[model samples]
Structures are given as C-alpha cells and as structure tokens.
Target: MDDAANPLRIPPQMSVYADKHNLFHLLQRMLTGLLIDQPEDPISYLVRLLQAADVPKIMLLGPPAVGKHSAAKKLSAELGAVHVTTDSLLEDQSELSAEARQYALTHQEIPAELLIQLIKRRLNSVDCVDKGWVMEGVPQTFLQALRLQQAGVIPQHVVMLEAPDDVLLERARGRLVDPLTADVYHQTFLWPADDAVAQRLEKRRDLPEEQRLADLQRYRREVTALTSAYQHVLRVVNSDQPITDVYQQVAAFVKTRRYYRTPRILLLGPPGSGKSHQARQLSEKYKMVDVSCGRLLRAAAADGSAVGDEVQPYLDGGTPVPDPLVLKVLDKRLSRLDCCSRGWILHGFPRDLEQVRSLQESQHRPNRVYFLEVTDDVCLERITLRATDPVTGERFHVVTRPAPNSEVHKRLRTRPEDGVDTVTQELRLYRKHTAALQSVYPDAVHIDADQDFHSVFEALESRLTAD
Candidate 1:
C-alpha cells in the first residue's frame, strides 16, 4: 500500500498494541473534539483533551428525594468537576434558546428537546469539557437520556440511586431546604449542625404526596430505559442507606475506568486439559466464535481455499501444519466479522515459543490467555478413556460418561491420537514448551482442570467478567 493509501504504514504489531491499549479510541475522540470545536490551536486543544481523559464525567440518576443533588455536589467538590443540572444550565439564559429561556422562568418541567439542548450547551462548555462534569438528575426521562447521548453528552459513570417507594415518600415528607445555601436536609436522615441554619431551614412543600407518588411511578417506569442506555457504566447504589456510605460506594465506582474490551481469548494446556470443551462453553455463553485450530484447519482444507490447498497436504499426511500456514488460516478466521465483533476463543495452536511470537505480532493477539492446569495422570486418563460416538459425534468417557445404550457403546470409536502412547507424546511435547508459554503470558489465568467441568467454567467466567 502507498503512503497515501496506508498513510503511516504502521507495523501489524503496532495495530495490535493500539487495539490493546485503546489508542485508536483515544485518537478518534481527540479528532472528533478537534472537528467539533474547530479550535485554532489544535495542539493545545489535544493536550487539554488528553489531560481531561481521566476527569470524572458522571451522572447522578435517581427518583425524587434520592439525594442526587447532595451527592453530585459532594462528588464535584471531591473531583473538582463542574456540578451540571437543569438549574445550573438555566442560571445563565444567554446560551439558551428564547423558548428555553422562557421555560426556565415559568415552567415546572422543561420539554425533552429544550432540556437536551441546554444540557448539550452546558456540557460542551470549556469548563465542563476540560474539567469534566457531574450531571445531577436533569434527565428524568429516557428520551432525554437518549438525546443527550446522541449529542455526545456521554457519562463515564452513571450512579443509579435506588430506594424503596416508602423510603422515598418518607424522605420527601421530611425534606427541608436551606434558604441561604440551598442545602437539602431531612428530619430523620439529615439535619443542619448550626442553629442559625436550622432556624432558616424551610420545608420543601412543592412535592406533595400525590406529586411524589406520580414522580416515583414515572421514575420506576423510565429507570429501565435509562439502565439500557447506560448499562455499561451504570452502578446501582442503595441510597436508602446513610449518605456517607452511599458516597463511598459511588465514589469507588466512579474512580474506576471503563474499558470497551473485545474478548480475544486463548486457551492453552496439555491434552485433555479441557481447552476445547471450555472454549466451547465460553463461546456459547459469551457469543464468541470458538476457533478450534485443528477443526478450523480441517474446514479450511475442505473449503478448497488457497490457504486450505497449501495446508491440505500436511493434513493428509497427518503431519503438523507449518507455522506460517497455521497463522494464515488463523488470520483469515479471526479477521472475519464474527470474531472481530463478537470476539473469539481459540485453542489447539500456538503451541510453542515461535508460534507465540507469531501470534503476538499478528493483529488479533489474544488479550485473555488461560492455561487449564491438569495433572499428567489426569490428562492421560481423561484422553485415553474418552471415545467418540461416530454417528452422533458425541464424546463419552468410559468411567465417567458411558454410552447411552449397548448399541452406542458398541459403535463408540476412539481416535488413534487418543491412544495412550500418542497422548503421552503430546503431553511430553506440551510440558517441554509449557515454561516458555507461561513466561510469554505470565498474567494468564491458570484454571485448575482437575475439578468438575462446572467448577473450571466458573473460574474462567469469574476472570472473564471480573474486569
């Protein structure tokens, strides 16, 4: 490819590194900001943008009397983020449309379009954009949330405050607002420390029993939609608890970064360590493509593709496919949309140091590597005792999983490779390269395959989702 066509002509490994570190995402975000702002000093704008990457972009979402305002204020103070809301945006009508300005004065509820417009303007401001912001309870409806997202007002963390209906009602009844500072206080839950502040505290009267109930109902109905919109970043907090406890939980969650990971998983272990079985389980559950290297080679050869033709002779001769050919088949298989989007869990390849290096250099390097650890004795027994029902292609173990009937048992066939001698050789080869493989992926999850199938799966699942 020419420089004009493939500008930087970055090495394949560079693409892999960028993907792993989310560098492309960062670049896209910076470019998008540049185009949107059209800043004269692009370099400085990008520097500010990079500096703002970790700044908190938070949303406090909850029903009435959930203490969202209080939480937003506390978080804003802690993180030095701008506390943004409908009231804050409406404070200065200079940026608002004439209709929104009029509504800011007279209307109890701003229309979705006007509210979204105001929020966009406020969040896009230099202060909010560079310093980050905490949006406190302005988007009371799903439509408002959707519109805000469409306008690029995405929150890095969505603190979904939840409380029982009774608790909310009681909170609303006890609500008090300070005239001077506009701080919220409650009769049982919270109170002002200073006598002067208590003396000036005014009961919140606008939210009557009927209004509170209606608001709660509306929130309950719209909360599901909000969750769907921000599910990835949303963390539910039991706001019925003490405000301090709630803040701690919300703070811990907000401090963590969110990653949009595309799961490229690799399973490695000796024969009968259940790599293929576990790969299938993960693939089925997580909707990732199960790329069994041996099976893929067979399919490729059957498909009559160029790669298949090159590797077919080796397959026919029962010899190992060359590293280049295996990598070729893998590159073609893993680059497909299904693997790229839905992700993939591959096994039965990259069995040595050279293969590992080749894979690391490839564009689709595995982010999640797992070694299913099983004892040699267990591996030998598991492989030697297992037989396949040729008619149904169902695997059966002689000791653990017997054939369903006499006919099936009689028809069950064991592969020549599964013989004790062949499995022993394979295990020996695996052991020889195991240390180097471990060195390559020191952080790879080590799953104990000696346990039951379900236990091994749970271990893998925990690691897969704990992120």
Candidate 2:
C-alpha cells in the first residue's frame, strides 16, 4: 500500500473514537500553542510560532466569497505579512494596457511567466522582504506551482478551505464588487455604506451562461490538478464550520503550512433571474467555482450512460430535474475539487418550494438566496433578447448571441421552432412558473430587474452593500 496515498496521510493521528468536544481547542494547542491566556494579538503569535515550527510560504485556496480575502488581511495584519491580491494589482494599473485588457476580456489566466516576473518584482520591493508575504490568486495551476517551486519559491505549507456548494453560490449571488475599489459586499452579510463606496461598486451583468459555467468548470479542473501535484505540502480544511471556528481551524492549519483562501456561496433566484450570471462573474473576479446544477446535470446527461439517460429526459423536456439526481451529480462534481477545498458559487438547483424543502431535508442549504425579482413584462423582454442555438437548433434565453449577425440569431433563422410565438409561449411558461416559485421562498430578497441591466445591478449592489 502506498502510504502517501492513504487518507491518514492527509491528517494524521485521529482515532474514530476521539473526543468531539473541545476538538478545535485541542487542535489549537497542538498546532499553535494553547490560546488560553494568549497574547492580545493571536495572529502575530501564531505567525512567529509557525516560523518556529519551520513552516513558511503558505498558500491558501478555496471558493470565492468565503472570506478568503478578509482572512488573509486579518492574518497578514497579525503576522506583518505583505498581502498581495489581483485586486490590489488592478488598482495600481493606470489603465489596463492593451494586452492586460485583452487578457481580462478573454479571461486568460495570469501566465506563469508573467506571474513569476510579478513575484520577482514584488519580492524585490523593500516592503516585501523581511516581512513574510502572502500571495492570493496566483499560480492557478500545478505547472505554475511547480515553476514557483523550481524558482525556489516553494511554500512550506498549503491550505484549502471549502464550504458546501449552496453556501458559496449564495455568497456569490449576494456579492457586490465595487468596480473602482474592488471592494466586496454581501447582501445580508457584509453591506457597505458611503455614496463613494456605492458609486465605485458595480454589479457585473455582461457575463453569459456558457461563459460563467465554463469559467467555473475550468477553475475546478485547474485548481484541483494543481493541488494534487503538491500532495506532500498540502493541508485541507473545511470552511463550512462557523466563521469563528473556521477561522481558528484555518489559523491552526496555516500554523503548519502555506495556503490560499476560498469562499463559498449558495445562490437562489427565480428562473432567468440572472443567478447564473452573477455566479460566473463572482467566480471570475474571485477565481472560484460556480457550481451550477443545470450545467452539472447537462454534463452528466451528455455522458450517455444509465444515469445520463435518466437526466436527459428532464433537461430535454425543459422540466426541472429532481433533487436526488441533482445531489448525486453535485456530489460527483464536487469530489473532483476535494483537493481545492476552496469555496464555490452555487447557482441553479433548489428551485421553488419543493427544491428548497429538499435542500433542507438533505441538511445542505445556501447561506443566502439573492432573488432577481423582475416583473413579467421585464422577464419577457429579457428572455426575448435570446436566440436559438446554431448547432442544436434549441432556443435559449440565456446563451449569448454573437451580435446582429450573432450565432444565436443565425441559428434562430434556421430553426423550425424559432418562431416568435414559440419564444412568447416559453416566456409565458417561465413567468407562470416563477410566480409560483416566488411564493415558495418568500424570504428571498427581491432585486428589481425591470431597470437597465446596470441599474438592476446597481440595485443589487445597493442591496449587498446595505448588508
């Protein structure tokens, strides 16, 4: 048996019958010394203690919106570590050079060469030396991590933090990023104030469904692969626990390793309410997963197996898939990111009253639900903006069209079912179902989608900032 591959290697010396109570306290003592009568600055103490433990160059990875940045800031402040994130870099840029802007638009990752250069640049800075530096949102792949390692930048420890998918999606959905400052606000959890804050923050609306899902899928793949390659240096932690508890546990983990931060959100909304849109943007901005049930189910169905056969009917019929199947699919997809332990953005699934009930029954529920409440007329208008698929001839309201000669419009021109009446009827059904769905989850926040897309996003930003 390969001992390295064993689960025991992941977190050693834990018996099945170990005491559950005071578990965290036990971990804290063993990892970072007893917090009992500890110094006022626990973070600073932990950093010095960890250095004594011979751990340095920590990397933290997790889904976005799970408080990764906050945790990093708090930890850095405590340890006098230099904190670096993409948002900080973007802020310092005068204007994204043509190449940089192109990279942003295309969602091309920060290349390892560029990242390496940036690291060298940062490291040479007076502030970055002596004081340990904590890097966020770089080396998104195993190859990149390897490149850093070969460059003698190997982190002493790596940490991955994750929450349930729904929590991540909700967090993503409720999030508002101030475009000017790159400040984040969660609708019910972390609302911000100040007109300047409000004006600078912008809710993203340009992302399309396919792009959102693709980005999420890509993050799950790349991050997981990267982490696996550094199995020996990694330490995984679940952020699903309460913030205080998660904070304590993670502090302990980093006390022994290098790591990244991941935030999870559970997104909830009406049909075509742009929940998926929000999820993708958050994932890109935060470099996390958008755990979309629709995409997950479709992927499973595309496999053409027994389970896929069962899933095909629901998707093909334009009906909601069952919760059990949704869970099964989610379980499998999430397993792929077991190494990431980063937070994720959960979009789709948990629709209507039954789905909500199902989620509760499974004991996995979103931290929040960001409802995009549009009038029937507004929803109709938004849905009509969509066109048919070029290849399959399937009409969809969410997929992006190329332009006036958009692939979507071109496809609509040829599809037999692309008539105005068909679209109108589909919109009608969408409205009818969503109205009922609203009644089921009465607590869901209502964001007005009747305004211009940016205005709607402004309202969303306002709601989130208010929190």
Candidate 3:
C-alpha cells in the first residue's frame, strides 16, 4: 500500500495510546515512504508509496467541542482530504432538496433516506471520494453507519474519543456560543481581552450546570452504544490528554485500522408510550442513536426499497410491526452504523413472549433491558395531544390558542390504538403479559407510569445515577 493513499494526523490525546511511536505518523510513513511535512500543524499528513492501498477513512467520536471536529479538520487539511462536519452538512442547501426538506420538516431528524443520499453525494464528490476525506459527527448511530455502508460508505477506521466526567463538564461549561451568529468562543482561549462584544456576551445561565452535566452524561451513554456497534472497526482514544499528545495517539490508531472493534446493542420497548421519546432523549443525552423500528420501516418505504415490502404491510395494517420483523429490520439497520461504540436506544419492538424469545434467540440482547411501564391510559392521552407531520409522519404538539378561538388546546387526534376504549383493552392485554415478561427477567422494574412523565423518569434516573 502506498503511504500517500492514507493520511495520519496527531490528535489531542495521544499519550493514552503510547506504544513505540505516534500511530498516525508511523502509519503514514509506512504507507507513503515520506515523513509528515509539518508535525507542528494540528493536522499532519503522511503518505508514502508502499503504493496502491486505498487510503483508509477515519471518524473522530466525542462529546461536543471535545475537539473531535477541530482535530478531524486539522488532520484533513494536513492529509489533503475534504473535512465534513455536521454543521456543514446541515447548512448544505443543495443537499436539502424537496425530499430532504420534507424529511427535516416532518421527522425532526435527517431521515435515513436523506442521509444515504447525502453520503452518496459526498462520496461521489471530486474532493471527497477521489482524494479521500476526514469526517466528524456524521454517522452518530449504528443504523446511520449501517445505512452508509449498505450504501457503500464504509469508513476504513473510527477513533472513539473518551474523556473523564470532570474534564467533560469543565469543557461544556467553558464553551460558549453566540446564539445569533452561531459563532463559538471558548472562554479560556477564544475570548478577547477588553473586547466589548465579548464582555456583553452572557453565559446561558438559564441552562443550569445540572442540565449541562445531564447533557454530557447523555452523550456518553449514546456514544457507548454506537461504540458497541462498531467495536471491531473503532480505535478508542482518551481525548482528555494534552492536545499534542492526543493527536499523536489518533495518528497511531489510524495506522492500526484493522485492529479495531465493532459495537452492538439490544434496546426494547413499545410505541406511543415513552419509548421513542426516552430513546431519543437518552440517545442525545448519551450521544447514541435511537433506532426505532417504526422509523426504520417508514424510511424504507420512503426510500422506495425492498425493505418496504415487508414493513409497509404492518404500517398499513395499523398494527405494531412484529418483533421478528422489527429485529430483522433493525438487524439490517445495525449493519449501517460502522460502529456502535456510542450505543443506541432500541425503541418500539421486542414486546411479549415471541419478541423476547426471538431477541434472545438472535442473541442480540441489550446490555440491560429497560421495560418502560407506561399505563395504557397515559400513552393514549399523549398520542391524542400530539400532532404528527404529514411528510415525516413524526408527532409534535400543534400549539394552538387557549379557549374557543383563543386557541391553545387544539391537538392532533390520537391513533385508534391510543383511544380511551383501545387503551382499556391494551391495559388488559399488558396486565396479562406482564407476568410472562417478568418471568423472563425476575428483576425488571414494574414502574408506575400512571404518575407524571417526570416522576417516572426520576425513578429510572435514580437507578443510573451514582448514589
């Protein structure tokens, strides 16, 4: 393999992976036969010609502002590969065509179809595909990575960046963004002395420290799932190290791409309850993807693909997509996220005797299964008040005025399964199945979801929170 084909750059936390030499630089030299031209640059490039191997691509995963984006971009510049960030992708109007627009409007997400299309577009670009690229914040989940791979967008390597909780919290707190201009300024380094604009800028005091901690913890949880999925293809890096040391480690990890691991997960729940909401909230909180079966099935249909054939029937039937089919679809979805080292939220599937048995049989079980115990009544009420988007078919509140024309109470009608009478029937079914399900897990908590959402969440939170 020609070293010129692949690039190696030092990242911020290289000391943790200390072996004989910097992995990125060593690999770069081995491949290209040329020493990195500029070691001082944040991004270093090494390409020599053992000469014909495809330059392996690398992804830097870490919580926001952990320098994942900064490191990847620097490396890209040094390596001469196009650097892609989530913000860049988000702002690309050309990529946000009618389909993508509708998806954005409806789902509150960059739909899988849109993502596949975008990856394809990026892969075909003269800069990205031909010379190779360094990407950050793209495949945030097992499913997203799988979508890219299934679409043939596999990365040659992934760098999993981890930091201590204290350092992460400090980083989060020190970070500041100009809300209006979307400009970021780190208090310690970017702030200008005696600059009126900087002085006038205020920290988001409304967002309490606890919230920041919550956000960081949530990110860790999500990333844990993603890491699991792509464990085999990922190289773990501790980003808490000094910037120069970090880069050296990242470069070194890139050199040993084949020695990485892929990640996996097993999340279970029912829909219209708190499953999807919690899944997403937790995923964002953890930095993992919430892979909902319903969402996947819809994406398949929208993409006009064969997966739709099996999924469309369940949707049309107005019934829950079966556990077997859900798992099957998700099994496909899992293959997309090149790595699940970050973890994911498995929403709405794997319910009842068959689903559980099927899940166990497949041997793809969750590290810990959480049975969200929402009463049928509560689930029904929530669905009734939430309006769904016609395009993405996502649910949201149709904020309206209060009292008569004053508006505030108008809402999207509930699904028939969520109607009062249906709820009663469902509750009866749930009661009957609870024993059987609990029998499978002697320790599963039977939460009283009859209480407020916050209260129920508090119960779950206590379990995960350190005493």
Ranking by TM-score: 1, 2, 3
Which candidate achieves the best lDDT against the true structure?
Answer: 1
Candidate 3 lDDT (Cα, 0 to 1): 0.58
Using all chains and alpha carbons, the TM-scores for the candidates as numbered come to 0.65, 0.41, 0.40
Q: How badly does each model clash, as a count of residue pairs? A: 0, 44, 86
Please report how far candidate 2 places residue 108 from its true position, in Å: 33
Q: Compared with the true structure, what per-residue lDDT tens digits does model 2 show for residues 429-456?
A: 5555676656655666677755555676
lDDT of 3 by residue, 1-467 (tens): 11232133222133213212334333533433223223343232232222223665667777755768657866777777777765555555683555566655564567776876776676556666457778887677667777675565556678877887887767767776566544455686356345766766656544478777766776776786777556556777877777678888887767663632112233333334566655666566546667876677788666555656777887888877766667766665543322133445565555577776776665344544567766555565565555544444545543322222222224334456555576666667766776666677665545555565677666654443111
* True-structure lDDT of candidate 1: 0.83
lDDT for 197 (candidate 3): 61
Error (Å) of candidate 3 at residue 384 is 4.7
Q: What's the lDDT for all of these models?
A: 0.83, 0.58, 0.58
Error of 3 at 407 (Å): 3.9
Q: What digit string (tens of lDDT, one per residue) describes model 1 on residues 258-367?
A: 75566789999999999988998988776889999999999989886767788889999999999988998787777665665567899998899999999988787888
Which scores better on TM-score, 1 or 2?
1
Q: What does the lDDT read for residue 309 in candidate 2?
A: 82
